[model samples]
Target: MVSFGIWGLIPPVLTITLAFITKDVMVSLFLGILSGTLIVAGGNPIIAILNLTDMLAGSLNDGWNIRIFLFCALLGGLVGMLSKTGSARAFGRWAADKLNSPKTSLLMAWFCGLVIFIDDYFNSLAVGTVMRPITDKNNVPRAQLAYILDSTAAPVCILVPISSWVITVMSIVKGSEGFSSLGISEFEFFMRSVPFNIYAILTLIMVLTLILTGRNFGPMAKSIKYAKETGKLYNEDYGPAPGEIEVEGEQNSSKARPMDMLFPILVLIASAVILFPMTTYLGAIDGESITSLGAAMGSMSLGDAFNNTDASMALFYAVIFTLLITYIYYTVRKLFTIKSASDAIGDGIKSMVPALIILTMAWTIGSVIKSSPEDGGLGLAAYLSEVVVGGGFPIALIPVIAFALSALISFSTGTSWGTFAIMIPIVMPIVVGLAQAKGLMDGAMLNSVLISISAVLGGSVFGDHASPISDTTILSSTGAGCPHLEHVATQMPYAITCAVCAFIGFLIGGIFLNLFVAWLAALGAFVLALVFLPRIYKA
Candidate 1:
């Protein structure tokens, strides 16, 4: 059964454990995919091989992922160039000389991760790569750096209005005939619903607090302790050290010009802003409603509507433009040689090998699940939700449980979009039905506005942020070059802390406040988490 694939947790977990235990992530992941293929194909090795081949092909053929990988590759190239060109080092040196404090550098790193809300995958890759060395230079562990990037990735997107996610979610909601039968404008309802999104708000607060206060917990806390004790984190036992980047050359003595750092970064942000929404509009349909801001064009090309060709093209064009501009800038300024550019691209592609393999495996497993029995998926998900929220538990507690369940499902399945695509449609209708039954429609009574809002937010984002198969999660681990489970393990404690506070806030909102007051209280709770928790982290 598709939903029964919650057991799907076993594959990735085992694979990650194999990597951790044997100290070889690539082999472990490949073997894990083989194991999953066996399970899904009923142990017939012949069918398993056939399915595996198809699954791998589908992953490679998917235009969306190609765009993502290309973005990552380009980001890698950009980071490589920046480092070789002496840009990143110059900026780091300047920051060290001026900003000076670990707290300020960490805070700046956190802020950069938080504000890049165009797309979570892009945010995770770009921020993690750019900030890792900077954070490392300040003695921050890669684990801590990974956590900051992971924390900001999905949470920030949920809170923003014009993100890639917003465009997609709006399209889904607007198109769902089931939702339109309720006579509410989707965008307006979504906006109204945003404030009570406790997970997003709280996660953001937790990240900021962690950055400012430097606390680490769970595997993260352990990783930080290990790094402090042994002077390494992530691949410390095997990977290159900070000072080992270059040896026995004048290059080691050369410092980068500051403009080298600022220019590529500025180009990246500007290009993303100009290009992301442009693609969405380019993908819009003639009769479909479009809500995001970037495109002034009212109609999309035919190629945009039914084909991956258009969407992928838009992403490629955007990335190519950014890369070209970056290349031209370096050329004009005499900061890069053509040989160096070639080397940067080569290094970037080399770095992507592991990520490409992991992604291929993840997609295979997803395809495997989708091919399972239909009743299995919807039934199991519904059952899971009911078990968590359907008990005699107080209505106020439902949202907390919902968040937990969604987080678990997402973390296990490794696909937030899939989790959200399945969960929100189901949960939203239930929440609305409950609100109407309780006479809480439009603040008509003090029934469960807080409860309803929290359910949707927690359900949607829990999966988005934590799912091992999640694009954001995969991207974060790949970007940070930390082991995948290492990323999940380190992030769990922080995510749980925010979830707990959100639950408490939900209780207060449901029991004691009006809808408006309830949302304000939740927002206040988010700020409170930022303040109190920062003091507790030992990072």
Candidate 2:
């Protein structure tokens, strides 16, 4: 059953199709889960119920993965509250007033996307929502806005160190004996791999190039022209209609201030960066490494004097602090009434219900996949590695193949995290085996590991950016209110352009430089964008 690719995908495909047809993702995901449960349990009615229970329980117990969904839900609530408070509108007004040029606005969108790399979902949602109105006001199309958000999410995370995705992948890698014996720490190896992550580097370059060149073509070109001519992107009315802004904008309103918006966002980021590293540095942590929550927990424990009671509960503490601080600031600043805060939280949780359901189904399928090695499911990595090793394939092609595999699975599954979870574990072993066979030292083996991981991440993000059913795609479309298919159609070409060029760059980097250099060299795609963009738009 695990050997059947279609078997693994059937339930998810049916669910996604249903969602698209009904325009209800929640229903689609639920039905998908149900279908999987029924199929796996073989129609034993009681056992089917039991399987569903176990799936739900297992997902809840999955710790970080589940916690992330919860965190996203809370953030969603914050967004909702902020929306109702008109904080987003105020920021839009400010952005519109400050950044009057389309090029600058586009650059700002790209920059914000790059900087907000802590979590992909947050990147997709927050950045998309905040930037959409501003972009539309500046005559940027919704398809363009979706492209910006979709491009930044996985690509930036693949490059960053402290991201949740990195931590998760690192944990999985450390579980492998081959990885452990390599004597290369995960962070060190991850950094080395950064330059080899061709997809990320190239995407970043593409973003900058797009901003500088202002070239639009295909669906994007059409969308941009339509936006400029009709003055409607995603059918949205940007700001108050002309003279209406003079009337409505002048009312003495008690909406949330810009400070109210910036404070919580800053706190979330600071807590993750400062607290995460400090705790790890202080040595109160134990694991593969100290996570962001662990660091926050360590601070609370050591700072509390004698008891050190809060040490084990760092994540809980950090989450509470974030939620409370965000609520208090929003409430006191009149961003929302107290009742609104509570309602926002509830609404936020509700918004995340679909994600939670999907997460569980994904985990269930992942659990089945993880059990695959036991049943001779060496996975695609094993098969590809075997072919590459036997055929004496050039090292230059490793990143390309790995990236393509990641992209393929991610696009099919509509989830980057799932792609990472599936591919990294399998790819690490292949890298180690190949290194040993080639008489490479620990250092060379580590290089392979880094390169492989980079490829996986790059591919995963590339797929997510283009996949019609991807969560980020949905979120991007929802944020911009662009038709999902339209966004997907418009974005795929640009993403592919980066992918092909990045693949070439990766091959060159692998042949000449080490993995990191190869990945870094892919950043040259920005230059490619500069050279070709004018022609694209001109056409």
Top lDDT hit:
2
Residue-wise lDDT of candidate 1 within 1-539, one digit each (tens)? Answer: 33443554455456545644554445555565566676666679897777667667766576555655465456556555554565544544555565555577668767767656655765676566556666666666676776777778878877764444543344334332234435545444455557777777778777776665655445677777776787766644434322222311125225446566577656666665555446556545344475543332545543333222233345456557767888888777666578877787677566655545544454444444333334111132233334434443445554555566566555555544433433344444344445444545465322353355445456557666765656677677766667777777778767777766666666666565345555576667666665665456544
lDDT of each: 0.57, 0.61
TM-score of every model versus the real structure: 0.56, 0.72
How displaced is residue 260 in candidate 2, in Å?
Answer: 1.9
Q: What lDDT tens digits, residue by residue, belong to model 2 across residues 223-282?
A: 787777888775332232111111011221346454554666577666654444443444
lDDT of 2 at 112: 73
Among the numbered candidates, top TM-score falls to 2
Which pairs of residues have clashing backbones in candidate 1? 3-377, 5-8, 215-537, 410-467, 411-467, 414-468, 414-469, 414-470, 415-469, 415-470
Q: Model 1, residue 165: what's the lDDT? A: 52
| Candidate 2 global TM-score | 0.72
